[model samples]
Target: MTQPVPTTPRPAGTRPPELEILIPAYNEEHRLPTTLRALGAHLSRLPLRTALRVIDNGSSDRTAEAVDRVAAEGVPVTVTGCAQRGKGAAVKRGVTTSPARWTGFCDADLPTPVTAVDHAVRLLLEGWPVVVGSRRCLGAQLPVRQPLHRRLGGAGFRLLTRRLSGRVTDTQCGLKFFRTSVARELFAGVSCTGFAFDVEAIARARTLGVKVVEFPVAWSDQPGSRFRAGRDGLRVAGELWHLHRARHGTQRPTP
Candidate 1:
């Protein structure tokens, strides 16, 4: 399928001049063009300068080509090819390689509105350790098209995370910001390379005394999601147990 060509003007660098937005895209050729459009439309208006990096996690489709198109438009996009796949591994690569002091990761689908992203970055500037987007927080305006089981599963996962990690609510949101110095260390220590990577990041952050702040987000579901909840659910469950064991064992990394 011929994808729509990107129409937005290139975004100028922002004021703070050191923020990097790391987008982990896997097989998102169909969705990335629109996602980048929305993000570019909003970011082009912001005053903070940022470097945008798109890490292609071994996509078998046109994902790399699509991102290369954006890079050709002078969008400050860096596409790194990785043989190892998974969201966690992709995020780790993006975080560890960033030159900026502040780094963030957003889903390629960009389910949250771009304005909300501005808010999260603002919170980051306000002295938060890790500024995270939340769908369960009060005042959250979520997508109307989410399936019932997905919502229930999200709630269940957050509940388990609360008990297991003893952290704030909503650990699975795709949008999360970290200080570059902290992210460099955090991603280096992360072990899980799949869906439960978020939990592992949070656990390691808390263990390392990383201050965390949650920001309420306006989120909407996008189509063409690749996650299989049933299969991933079992994987996450096992990861949770393994994470706990690692936390208690001598294998845990020192903060």
Candidate 2:
């Protein structure tokens, strides 16, 4: 599945980056090895200073041990334990704990390759408050193994998001980058702990007048996703409604 080219252009500049890559893992012991290896190789080739954060979300598996083993290999790796489940909770913990100039979180499965990290960092360097992988954007390529029903669900979700949030082309991409200031501001206000957290984050960023750039991503769908599309979709939709009401509830009075 080829991605559509992005109409949104990145702001331009050249700056050496202090980037922290945050990976939120849940029962990803088998997947972590490949993802970490790919990320390590990519970071080794880059000139930017990079640190890796693996937030273990109370996996019954050996995910924490695998991350510890990788950290022992001399990479600037840090692991945080979030006993609470949910990807959003893990990301919140990691972002708040990481001490980098710029912070970003990627799914531990590496559905989007590490090269996308470079792209996201470049967007941050260019002055965007947040940069995100856009699966709906041009140049994004999804793997053939992706289930059609999930794809259809994603399309519907993006479409509904367009109606709710007018400025974004994609809202649910797992790879996201944020400048430290932006991350601090946005994540502090984040209340969602489930799949709809991405939408909430993006909404808050927009509310704060943060500049966001959605870039095309090269993504591959991986098996063993813990997501249950139908069940999770209902939860996501309900959360979106809650967020919508919260935004309205918090609106400032006009002069």
Candidate 3:
């Protein structure tokens, strides 16, 4: 396990934040500035105390320095280091350390807009313990579509997720939220720490009877995605099979 290093200390006598958004980044120095600025601006307009944290997922770039720059601009952003090199690991560390009423993780590229945070927070305040941003759900707007091959791959992955975890149309949306206490408890038991981690996390949440709602959002396919269709896809499939067998005591379902 890796320990997180906080770049800035929280001021004394400050109220605990109502929400904390974690961005798990790997070599995202150039992208962090724009994403952090937009996120800070969006959060400022909402009527809630919010904080942002960037988990540096073993990036060899200036990702941490970029976060520090944002914090210096008085954005209330914090940078933390994660020795482990997986999105799920970084998110687990962030969720465990968060001291907010609600916590969630979003992709570094901001595929789902920062405004979706407000939407998710509203659902949480309305008694939804878990909220997910979905691009395939009703009312979703996709301004830019993913490549045809990628869309086909996503469809297959979604089918597998539905089989293992019931009725979740899109588990890999990269924007997920949870009540703080519930997030801590669930992440503590997480074992998958890669592309398929979302599937396992949602599956576990379902088994624990957590109420989850998916909200459709406006989305755009961002450039410089780290996911490699063939390599990462195979690894995710294997992990899904392992997760299914471990939980259900049966062979993995075919997508």
lDDT of each: 0.77, 0.77, 0.86
Least well predicted 10-residue stretch by lDDT in candidate 3: 246-255
1-255 in candidate 2: lDDT tens per residue? 644321112126623237888888888889987788788878878778786778888789898788778767866566678866788888888777666788888887888867787788777878988888887777877764468888788778877666445567778778988888778888898888888888878877777777788899877888788889778778888887887777675764221
Candidate 1: misplaced stretches above 4 Å?
1-17, 249-255
Across residues 19-138, which tens digit of lDDT does each residue of candidate 3 receive?
999999999999989999999999998898999999998899999999989888989788888887788889998999898999988989998778788789889999998898988789
What are the TM-scores, per candidate, against the unseen true structure? 0.87, 0.86, 0.93
Q: What is the lDDT of candidate 1?
A: 0.77
The TM-score of predicted model 3 comes to: 0.93
How many Å off is the CA of 156 in candidate 2?
A: 2.3
